[model samples]
Target: MEFRQDINGLRALAVLVVVLFHFGLAPVSGGFAGVDVFFVISGYLMTGIVFSRMEQGRFSLPDFWLARGRRILPALLAVCATLLLLGWFRLSPMDYKMLGKHALYSVTFLSNFIYQGESGYFDAASQDKWLLHTWSLSVEWQFYMLYPLWLLGARAVSRHPRAPVWAVWAAFAASLAASAVWTTRAPTQAYFQLAFRAWELLAGALVFLHAPRLQASPGQRSALALAGLAAIVCSCLHFTHDTPWPGMAALLPVGGAALVIAAARHGLWLTGNPVAQALGRWSYSIYLWHWPVWAALAYYGAHRQPAAIAAGIAASVVLGMLSFRLVEQPAARLLNRSGTRPRVALALSAACAAVLLPAGLVYVLHGVEQRLSPKVLAIAKEDGNRFKDRVACEFHPGAADPLPRCVLGDRKDVRLIVWGDSHASAVVTAVAEAVPHGVAYYGYQSCPTATGVHYRGWDNTCVAFNEAVLADMRALPPQAPVLIVNRFASYVFGKDAGNPEPVPGVVMDDEPQLSTRPELEAAYKRRLIGMLCRVRQTGREVFVLESLPEMTVYVPNHLARALLRGERPDDVKVSMADYRARNAVVGAWLQEARTTCGVRLLDPTPYLCADGWCGGSRRLQPLYFDTNHLSERGNRVLLPLFRQAFGGLGARKLAAQPAATGQGG
Candidate 1:
């Protein structure tokens, strides 16, 4: 396939926006759409190569695959190996372990699946992820691995030259439809999986298949190129991370790339300029190197600031250029040498094994904790001490309920029903120890205890669990007390910007993504109050938890790092006034609810915050299991609040009760 300068310029544009978006350097919230652009460009070139070779009656699948391997593997292996080396010194044990796993996945081209599985509100943030950007490369590699076989299948079905063309278009439509449907239903899978993403690439194939018929005057070509550039730029500038990605909205960037490629205006200023051409030439390496640089800076807590962002961009570009010069060029030359396929393949395979063996060893050793100081390692070990037993107690869309878990005390009488999201689960033991009654914990991930609100994910619905809990409450005898614990501020304002985008919530049974909606706090308050009043009407005591102060970092890992750096772990604290200001809207609603619904409030501030600060750690002991969920020790501090709230409640009934029937936690 001949190189088109316009296409190179387009590559330059695509990588540039993606870089800027990640670093947050430009007004390009939609810069993520740039990957869609690259996908289209990839499809065009791939299809052109395969079809042209087939036309010449000399196309070999192995040769084609080898070419792709040579083009991709050398630089990929270089980056993975580099990260593995530096990650040992730079990352925490858990983070390094994660890198090892991610590196393994990236090497195997299965990172998309692994990353999809790891997606959650509770997982590590993007900047904490070194190879997070590799998921796209994984997707592309999967596409490469499969697309030729699909073409071969199409060719096998028909002798006509146009068979694969028709087949690809059909597949393009199906992929697009799957992307649209799943973008709403299963966003994580839709966003990361090749099935949903293949259409964007196929759009490029269709453009290549039909480019011959797109004849136009040079002026018309220029206009079309400009329009395509505008569309791509608009998507970057207009859309945000919260946008349902790779849905129908992705067509803007995909189509724009296809149009620019189809226009074939090699000298157009937008794409064919000197800078664009240079960036284009180094695009793959630039894409590969930029993320780890950003991730490293992000891990150090300095990224997204002006100096850091500028330094990161400069570092990424320089590293990319060096990688191109030293690694990609040398590998290309070696592979292009006469009859070097076997040696090249063998060498690349050896390189992969070299990376895989250590990465696997690192993962097996759990990030090799022996390297850390004893104190930091102890802090690292505290991370997995979640308050609740996740396997049996936690509820997700399809999580198994093999036991009567979350029943913290005697099962004879479930005197108290503790309900909310995961935040509720975090403090269930504290409530259990404080009360004499059998505590039935009804905690679901992401499902806050509000009647008119719905959390978008969690396998599409949180309806059945909440409803069942409510029904159980109604069936209970009068004067049954219920405690609701939720981290309210997250849904309203979102976690600190670098964390996963805030949970997309449907408030008042209306629009989703509450943070974007108008008067969301007020709506959430109405729904919450209504639910509390309804419970009260059923002769149940409704106790709602005041907002738990959100943490700026993962407390355990932050403390461990502080220890590792010999910095004071106590320095990592949330401001007391800031916490109040952050939760002002929810606070107002809580005040109104106390009068309107007579709900009892249990404030954590009195127990957790003091001296104008809310400690993420308690005197070197970590309080949080993650950014927001409390560890067992962390929630134990709130025992006083729970005892006070449940102190005046009547004793449990001693009447014969239903047998505790399931497996125990």
Candidate 2:
């Protein structure tokens, strides 16, 4: 139980890689493995504390729980409170609501579950989540809650002293197998959840139970420690965001950390260096403060600026130093001293409620929309509320009603049948309001509206959806237009820069080349053109919307940042040349259809782009809900264009639309 400076230095190593990885600095591509390293260290230290206390016959479960609560909750509550305060002035209603939910999750030690259902750990949207880093803390806290109970149960049931050690290794083996299999199939669960991560922490417990040899020479221990450090560095340098996580791959860092701890050398430069020890001491708070600062920078579109990243890192370290002195140290001193247990417990519950109650109010009040004026709220609108609900019929499958049953206009029988992916669904409300004809909408997320091609991992979902839509087109009158809409450039060039996840390669049923980019792009254009001609052959006219301009930043977030800074969010524009270049192949294929299949092309460029630039917002509203999907208000610009071709305007007129009202957030 003695203070091991090497362990402190190990803490430095873990936090350094994680911080560097999050900041997109240096070459620590696999820096996320640092969390694995910390798991090992915690297992060793906490197990040591529990067993040592038991030997002295003074161990109390409430006391153990209190010690952990004091260490984790104080500094955590500080970060969440600071973020909520900053969010009051800076975040849009939607993001503020999300932050409220995230804050509640963080303080309650359940963020891992919240994040598990949301998105991948390495997603671009991670920038929007101020408390995304708290998932690991939740994982560690879950382990802390369960580990000692398993130990006390094991000691009571078995006469053998070695029972818990055997149990730890047994659990490690079982968890390792499960982690590998689950990571391969359901990576989000493997990465963000604790079931797959328990083995790494248990490996550290094994290190404690089977202590390192005392007879080993100093030279051997130093060599062992250095080798452990090398293993950790190699994992960070060589692995990347795409690496399968917390599986067999994580053993490198977990094993490496266990070796460093077991080596028990306190004087080696790597483990004993002054800077290393300081970072180690401040590691917990540094981890807490670093992400919120960088998340703010990311919100303002400066995450990649070298100076901004430098400033963010500096700010995080300074904030960490201040938090350590003001919050972490004081809480540690008070709770570690003798006092009435119930008083400490009562105060802890009160602090949690203090943070939790306000967060709950923020979420329940809908991010308190009164924070912004009518003009700003107009741009923010249903986007700030539950937008997905409005579009749910198109994007989500209904058990009772078919997906295509989701119509845009009031009339049940539809003349204009819209077909595409979620991008198509996003424009339904606007399209319904713009056109006089009743619209039959069919949208499947991430599914390109083509007959023969699909994403590499996907089966026949998109192809099948397109077939069903084409059948509906065949049943309609010749005058009824079959509109083809999708985020087409994604099929050709992969996801936009602002999008998360590794690019899913396009695959064709007949292509000789499997998932190669060039071959896939060629096949995509061919299949798209073929589908349009097929629509023409179905005896219906085909209208294709030119791909909308995609922004490099999530539009709502950018606009909110701009407005918070007293700048015009509508002033935002992206390079038109760049948009044209990104979709050059798509445009060419659509143009080819005009001659080969009589398909008409409608360009969103005029509505979204002007003077060699594509804007994310206009005078009244932001153009997009996220990176590429147009907001309902923003998509209203397309109503004029759609009306010109389809020949009917709905009851709602865009110009006559009233401005949205607001509430204080």
Candidate 3:
């Protein structure tokens, strides 16, 4: 198969977009699509080479395997080993364990599946993951593993002459269409689905099978190449996270790449360009090595400026050339010459398994708890068992157990009942301390203690759970000082069901308008009034902890970066006034309830926001566990405010209190 310099330049374009986007460059929100473009190009080139050889009776599985081993494994192994060693020295035990697990998955080419199974990409845990980029490599490798067999079959079907190409092309088209639909309905699957991505490669393969004449004169070829380059550039600028991805939206880059590759550049203007060709030559190695280096730099907070990122790109290219010359080219040549590719591969595979097996065994033997100090482990237990688990129980079929199941306070002379959803869990430690003598808590995830409004698309099982929590609250034994606290955004944004799929920026209609402020506020007010009235009817003192102001900045992530740079994370806190302004409607609504609905508002804005700032902190003090949830220490700091409100309602005093301790994470 003849090499195309234009395709290598296309790879440079793809990697450029992804790198810029990762560095917080605004214009390239959709830069992640570069991976998709590579997939198509890879499919095309690999298929073209394999199928062409098979047609000439020159196909050899051993040779093919040797080629792939030389191309992929060495650079990848270098990166993984370096990252693992670095993690062992500097990362926390939890992070180190996670890195080990990530290594295990990466070595096996299954990281994509593992991550998809664990959580959606939007989750907090995914934010700090260093090997998250490997998921795409896994997807590609999985394809490499399967695509060869399909090519052999295509060769077998060549008795019908054109039938094989047509069949393959048709399958690719069908898969592409199915992937487009699935991308919207189940994007997580769409992101990792091998079948959906096959069409991109197939499009490339079709170009290879036909090798149709360009028919364009030199000038026209140059014009087409320039146009293709323009399309690629525009796509990087215009795409964003909200954009429907790898679906119809992916056509711009994929098609542009196809145009550049197939145009075969008879024009001296493009084909003769030395820099483009050089970039093209090392493009494969550049792609293989760049991300991991950027990942390490980003992890360590080394590269952020445009100049620095550009330097990283230059360094990547330099390293790529060296690697292509020394490691990749030599290893491939040696393996092919010696005919020991499989044996070498088996040995490498064994080494990986040997390293990974012990890591897994250690992980299991210690359990996940070995990562943290005893106090942190205790806090984590409170996070999971007491709140996350039990609160999930409130909305089903019966009342939650009236015992303060997960609260961290002393278990004696129960006085108050904390009621609502997982927002209550954020302050579980505080609640435990505030009520002491164990407050009877009633809460559930996604189930607001409200009636008349039913949420759709939630699990059928949750219908009973919702009814149960409401019933339990109704039966609460006239406990005064019943506190109703919840993260208000859920009610406003219709969070009872689940997060809505991110609507891409290119949508033609008014879906974004559907999630606007008025609709959310109206829903919030309705739920609040219903809950407030019901609690007051029981002659219980109802205190509504209006939702705490959420920090708009992704504080912990920012802090991690700052910490790596030897700066205090607290140097970056934004003002709480900003938060108040954003939630003025909710605040005003709370004020109205205080005046008209006889609901006492326990606004703790003062405790959280000093000098009108309501943001994250890093003063060796925990603030948020993630975006919206409070950390255990953050909750501990607020216990005094909670206690004052509960104490005012004649709440029972603490008895047999457990000593609360704090530990370094």
Q: Which candidate is the best by TM-score?
A: 1
The CA lDDT at 312 in model 1 is: 95
lDDT: the better of candidates 1 and 3: 1
* Predicted structure 1: clash tally: 0
lDDT of 3 by residue, 84-125 (tens): 666544444445556777767876788888777764344544
Best by lDDT: 1
| Residue runs of model 2 more than 4 Å from their true location after superposition | 51-63, 149-160, 300-302, 305-307, 336-338, 373-375, 382-389, 395-398, 410-413, 452-479, 498-513, 522-534, 568-570, 592-596, 648-665
TM-score of 2: 0.87
Kindly give the stretch of ten consecutive residues in candidate 2 with the minimal lDDT sum. 656-665
Error of 1 at 345 (Å): 4.1
lDDT of 1 by residue, 1-665 (tens): 88799999999999999999988765988898889999999999999999999889899888888888889989999999988898777567888899899999999999999889878212447667789889998999999999999999999999997899989998999999999999988889999999999999999999999987997999999988999999999999998877888899998888888889889987788787799999999999999999998877876678858998999999989998999999999988877873666876787788889999999988999999998878788888777877646557766565455223457776666677788888888888888888886777777777767775765444334556666667655544455578888877766666552343443354445545445445566667677777778887776778889988778788888877766665665645788888888788778887888898788888899898889998778778888877777888888899998888785454546344344444244
Reference-based lDDT, each prediction: 0.81, 0.78, 0.62
Error (Å) of candidate 3 at residue 612 is 3.7
Model 1 error, position 608 (Å): 0.8
Residue pair clashes in candidate 2: 368-664, 368-665, 369-663, 370-663, 370-664, 371-664, 371-665, 436-648
